[model samples]
Target: MARPGPRDGALRPARRRTVELVLVLTALGAFALCLAMAGLQIDGRVPERFPLYVGVVSAAALGLHVTLRLVAPWADPLPLPLATLLNGVGLTVIWGLHHVRGTDTNEADRQLAWTVIGTVLCCAVLLVVRRPQRLQRYPYLAAAGGLVLILLPMLPVIGIEVFGARRWIGIGDFTVQPSEFASILLIVFLAAYLGLKREVLGTAARQLRLGRVKIFSLPRMRDLGPMTAAWGVAILLLVGTRDLGTSLVLFSVFLAMLYTATGRKSWVGIGLAMFSVGATAAYLMFWHVRQRVAIWLDPFGPDVYTEHGGSYQLVQGLFALADGGLFGTGFGQGRASEIFASDSDLILISIGEKLGLTGLVAVILSLLLLAERGFRIALGSRDVFTKLMLTGFAFLLAFQVFVVLGGVTRLIPLTGLTTPFLAAGGSSLIANWIGLGLWLRVSDSARRPAVLPLPTPAEHATVTMRLSGAHTRAAENGRNGEVSSNTRATPQG
Candidate 1:
């Protein structure tokens, strides 16, 4: 068999920018249509801000697209478009709810402002980081920052407790969910630390055996510190904020990065066991946890539905979903506003109510595609830290989405997790956009072609003679300064 020439190794042209532009345009069109349909359904006329809304969203998306072209031309094209579509859908739902409730809050306008801010932050991340692996240099610092952010909501002056969960910090009239940003930072720290220590945790471990079969690998006692610390942090989150959702998310992402780094099923089993124990303890100790469990079990019961901290929101969301049927009630229709938090935690229910089962499926599929692209980037990455970072981010999105959708649909106890890209929160939007930027940077590195160094003419001649075994004794002797050769010299081993 013949080896291929240099032409065979040439890199293919990157079509990322073109693909991204088309998808962005499509997303913009869909958003415009959603707004127009809502306006027509509500008042038999288009909304006055329809064009302006489209223009603003398009400009924001275009700015990000252009930034990618300049800094990360080989980045995956799917995430940006998928995120744009989800954000647009979220805006449409917020707009529909505002109109239906006849509220003067201008939620849609506020969301648009957040979208602009998030996009700018996304661009800033790309410009500053340029290389994802650079983050590994400050793992401890990242972890500390994450811990501080998570605990910020517990501060006396800034902490804002809403609906029994103390998860946000208030600056005058503005509120920010610190946990959202904290989750990403924590994942960054986990990826770096786990990637650096995977070999010891994976191989330098004792094997647990049953008869002749090895059941699982257990890390050394000394190696157990990181996992124990993570578990402790999760429990602290649950205890401090009464926020079971963020605790679960943080712990789940840690478990995922650990597993990715080690390639061991044992880590997953151990992580789940720890989570089960923690959840049980939480259920026993916290009234909120028990209430959430009760709500999940029987939200429709009169006692449960009407009691303080009962399942009123959950039941309303279920009813809204039931009303939408298969094809939904169409845009600007349905009673989504009847449910509280319809634009945030219950955004999916709002979407299901107005767009029905079909649109709901489409939205879910888009999220899955975004996740798929992130996983693809992880798979292609050659650097361990980069791979783990991408994997952790993907798992974060997956778990957060599952928790939100499952809670709304009664598959699990309701938790205070917001749907990514589709939920109405500035903190979540900024965090997700930053995550996207990191993924893009990693993907660019993974997809870029490797360049091989070329040999000089004399070196090439030496290599040829060495491969041909054509060196005479004099030439071999000349290598040690015993003689000299004028024709050619053989390469040394």
Candidate 2:
């Protein structure tokens, strides 16, 4: 065989960053329009800091795009643009609500600052974690770090209770939600561990059989250790901090990634069973859980709505949603501000109130598209670790959205999980952006073409000599065949 030329198997830059840039610019334009609409409808003019907001968002977005080009040129483009749009929507709603409430909440400025911080952190992740496989080396360390972060809010001095959930820790004026960051770390640990142990965990010792056909596979009892550990962590969070959202998010993502890693339906069933038991126990044991369930079940009841920390806010959110109807009341024109935690926990309601079902669906679709892109990256990846990590990351985003939407819609009991990139929490925003960075980092590695090293001069010479010898043998065989054919033709006559 002939040796491959220099261009053979060469790495080609996909240069998808050009496409990404176009998408980013379009998102920025849409955001600017939304901001303008938000300000004009409420205050009868564009926002006073309209240019400033647009400039900041544009800079942050373009800066991220350039960073991707420099570091992760092959990374997926959709997430950044989607994130920018969602974050921009959050800022618009927050700023719009400030005027609606007639208060001096500097939330928009704070959110802008956090957006800068999140974008910087995102860039830092891309720059730092060049090789995601390196993460597979320290699964235990990541797990330990995640556990500590999850448990940090339980500590006395630094820990602070807000709205009856002890999920935030404070350093003087700076309050951070450790669980938000910890969730990613936990996913990392799970992805690495399961990627390594998948063969063992995914192996089914027992199979339910029907005559000649094998029906379903069952998980081994011993393989239950990791599953049980995840369940324990979730139960600990649920009971210890009383933050239903964080616990639910962490555990559900674990189960999803577990099923993904193992491809075992039994694991999902077991996880659901365990979650039900844990939730029931918590509901029976903890008043907070019971209260949330009561509010969800009967938000309009006088006994529930009139009680302190009852369903007043939930009812208000419902009312706000009802007011918006099919089409929204227009940006900055709804009564969502009257609902408690409208910018944070009830953000979906605020979005529904201002933008209505169509706009809400648009936001939901953006999130779904982002998650789908992550899943697509996972599918395109070659390495198991990369695939698992990307799957976990994608599951977290999708599951978190479901949980938030479920809670707001009363499909599930409300919990204190902020909408990723769309909620007003700095820690949540920063942590999610960092997750996006990880996704891009792993994606670059996954999609970037693998380059094979060229052979040395001696090796090349050896291959060339071998090819020459083969050609010489082929020439000799051809000569022999021609002579035989010429001689045999006379014999036929």
Go through the candidates in order and give each one's C-alpha lDDT. 0.87, 0.87
Tens-digit lDDT track for model 2 on 47-159?
A: 88999999998999999999998888878878889999999999988888887888874888999999999999999999999998899899999999999999999998888
Give the range of the ten consecutive residues with the poorest summed lDDT in model 1. 4-13
Prediction 2 TM-score vs. true? 0.91
Give the top-scoring candidate (TM-score).
2
By how many angstroms RMSD does model 1 differ from the true structure? Answer: 6.1
- Which tens-of-lDDT digit does each residue in 35-148 have in candidate 1? 899889877899887887899999999999999888888778888889999999999888888887887547888899899998998899889997788899999999999999
Off by over 4 Å in 1: 1-14, 307-309, 452-493
Tell me the lDDT of candidate 1: 0.87
